[model samples]
Structure formats: structure tokens, C-alpha cells
Target: MTSIDAARGMYFEDFAIGQELRTPERTITSTDIVNFACLSGDFNEIHANHEYCKRTPFGEPIAHGPLVYSIMGGLQYASGINDGTLLALLQIDAWRMLAPVRHGDTLHMRSTVVGKKETSRPDRGVVTFARRCLKQDGSVVQEMRATLMYRRRPPA
Candidate 1:
């Protein structure tokens, strides 16, 4: 995995509501599409067969929605925002695929802290982030709200 940035990650207390974080751009390649298809066994024509896709509105093969969603996880990891601070992914809410992701489309992720709450455990907190996957053209292709458990700072 290529690390886009060597920056340090933040603890739960370090995040503020509305603070945004971005991941480095990644270009979707035909190889990536093929690999995802083989791995996922989702050999749907729109994602695999070019000739079949030519008959569709897209005019060409497009990446699978799940593939794009999985890539978002990689992008978030590459961003290094959670790193050692994340405890678990508690939930994903309101996930939507708004646009098709085609091969050669460059994409990036933008995440904003939308909510935060201290947990009764004291050592952990819950944070909600609104995340979007945007194409290079600035159109949002996918979006979701994610809730995560994060490690809180130890007492000073």
C-alpha cells in the first residue's frame, strides 16, 4: 500500500465538528476494475464485458459500486487520519451511489466530522463523519455517513 502522507493521526479529542480531511487522488484503472471483478465474483456485464456495456447508457464498462465503496476504505487508510486512533467502524449510514465510476476516472475522498460524543467507557469516543467520493470533475459519485469508535487520550 502506498502511503500518501506521513502525517500523524489524531486522537478522538483532536477532531472538531466540521473539520474536513481529504485523501490523495487515485485514478481507477482497467486493471483495478478487472481485479475487483475477479475478487468479488461480480462479473456483471456493465463492469466486465465492454461489448455489453456499449449497449448501455454508460457507453462503456463502469466500476462496480461495491468496488468503489471498497476503494474509499483504501483511500481513507491512505489518508492516515485514523491510523492508530481508530478502534472500530461502528456503522455506515445513508450510503448512496449517485454516479457511475468509469475506468480512468480519478477519484478522491473528503471526510468531515459531523458529530462527536464521549463514551461511558472513558477510553473511547464515538465520532460520526460525513464522507464523499468525488470524481476529478468534482461530481460526487458516492456518499455515506460513518460512525467510528476512536481511542481517547489518556489522562495527563
Candidate 2:
């Protein structure tokens, strides 16, 4: 097996408000939708029944909101921006599904550091990121603010 160097991502002190990271795009697929449905037990017709969805405003089965949210998490990880520096996912604030995500649609994420504060604990600090999931057409399909804790770099 080939060994790959682990990425030690930025610590809390390395983040600045307005710093943005864009992730690579990924296309949604029917298999992905089915797998997510099986894993999440969300069999909503809007997400699972193409025939039923054909009558809806979206005109076809759309991906689940939580599924898209999960993909955003993956996209962030793939960016390697928080590989090892992340302490915890503190909270998700103001999450919104702005548009439908249908199979075959390509999506990508753009995350901007919107807020940061030192915690009372000396070991970690909070950082808030404004994350947007944009479609191939450049329209936003989802958006949210995620607050996370990151470890502080040790003194040199």
C-alpha cells in the first residue's frame, strides 16, 4: 500500500473573516440518490419516486436536502482545508435549501469564514463559515452557516 502524507490543516488562529475556499464539482447520480435514501431511510417521493416527482414543480426526482448537506461535508473534507485542525462541528445555523438538486446536476461548494472568536478554553476556538452549494449553472441550491471548533497551535 502506498502511504500518503496526512494534511495538518489550519488552526483557529489561521482563519480570518472572509477567507474563502472553493471545492471541486461533483455530479449527482441516481445511484447516489438511492444510496442516500437507503442510508437515511428518507423515502420521500420527491427524492425517490421519479414518476411521482414528474408531476411536481421540479419535474423529476430531486436529491434529498440532507443528502446535499452531507455532500457539502464531503466537499469540505476533500478541500483539505480542515484535515487535522478541526476539533468539532459546533452547530449548523440558518441552513436553507434554496433550489432543487436533481440527478445529473453538478454541484460545488464555496465556504467563507464569516466569524471567529476565542473560547474560554485555551485549547480551542470557534470559527463560523458561510457555506453555499452552487449548481453547474452558478445558482445556489443550498446555503448555511456552520460553526466549528479548531485546536490552537502550540507555542513554538
Candidate 3:
């Protein structure tokens, strides 16, 4: 990976409604789940203890919802959609978990700008986007709408 300068921040003016951004594929493995489980203390049967999950309706272990959500961060950074520019995640809305994410699944993310508005402060703006995580087979695993604070490009 190339080194990045983190000094600059994105301004709300940079985004357009209907703009689409996609990320490269990311493979998820058992170790990834285990690490997330240990790091987040989310040791639920579906996410960590596979044998215990066999008794559930899904009949197998699934990834945690927040774990799936975390994928968005990787997507954002890797895709250059928010790289070095994003200031903060302000809010997320209508977050939904769909099909279960199993080990060895490949995931990708796409986001579309739904709206954008300039902030009262001249240096920043708010951007709202609809985001989705999809499996290799194109099945949607999770979806949400997010709002972020972005810094404006400095005047030349």
C-alpha cells in the first residue's frame, strides 16, 4: 500500500448526489471473525461459537452485524471515497442485516450519494449516502444510510 498524507480533509462540496463509489473485493475468513469476536467482545454463538450456532434456524454460524458494518470503513478507505478527506461519521440510518455472511465469503461495498448540504461553518459540509455490502454472488449482506462531516478543499 502506498503511504498517504492525512493532513487534508474532504469538504462537503466534493460530493454529488447520485455519485456511486465501489470498493475492491475483500475476503472474509474464520480468523477474521475470531479476531473481531475477541476484539469487540461479541462472542455470540453465530459469530464465534460455530457448534452452538448449528441449533439455530440458519443452521450455521454467521458474522456479527456490526462486523459487517465495519466493512464499510475498509471500503471507504480502500476505494478512495473517503481517503484522507473524511472528518467523521455523523450518523447511520436504516441499517439492515440481510443474508448471513459465512467464512470464506468475498465481500464488496458500494455507496451512492443520496444528499448533500453545506454546513453553517464554511469549512465543512454534511454528506449523506446509501451504502451496501454485497457477497461475491451479488447478494446483499447489509445496507445503511450514513451521514458524514467533510472538510472543504482549501482555497488555492
- How high a TM-score does candidate 1 get? 0.93
Clashing residue pairs in candidate 1 (N, C-alpha, C atoms within 3 angstroms) = none
Residues 107-148, model 2: lDDT tens digits: 999999999999999989999999999999999999999999
lDDT of 2 at 151: 85
lDDT of 3 by residue, 1-156 (tens): 986456533456768899987888898888888889999998887777668888888776777888878876886777776766788889999999888898888999988999998889888888998999999999999999999998888676
lDDT of 1 by residue, 18-67 (tens): 99999989999999999999999999999989899999999998999989
Instruction: Please identify model 1 stretches exceeding 4 Å from their true place.
Output: 1-7
lDDT assessment of candidate 2: 0.91
Highest TM-score scorer: 1
Model 2 steric clash pairs:
none
Instruction: Determine which window of 10 residues in candidate 3 has minimal summed lDDT.
Output: 3-12
Q: List the global CA lDDT of all models.
A: 0.92, 0.91, 0.83
Q: Candidate 1's error at 75, in angstroms?
A: 0.9
The 10 consecutive residues of candidate 2 with the worst lDDT sum are: 2-11
Ranking by TM-score: 1, 2, 3
TM-score of 2: 0.92
Residue 131 lDDT in model 1? 95
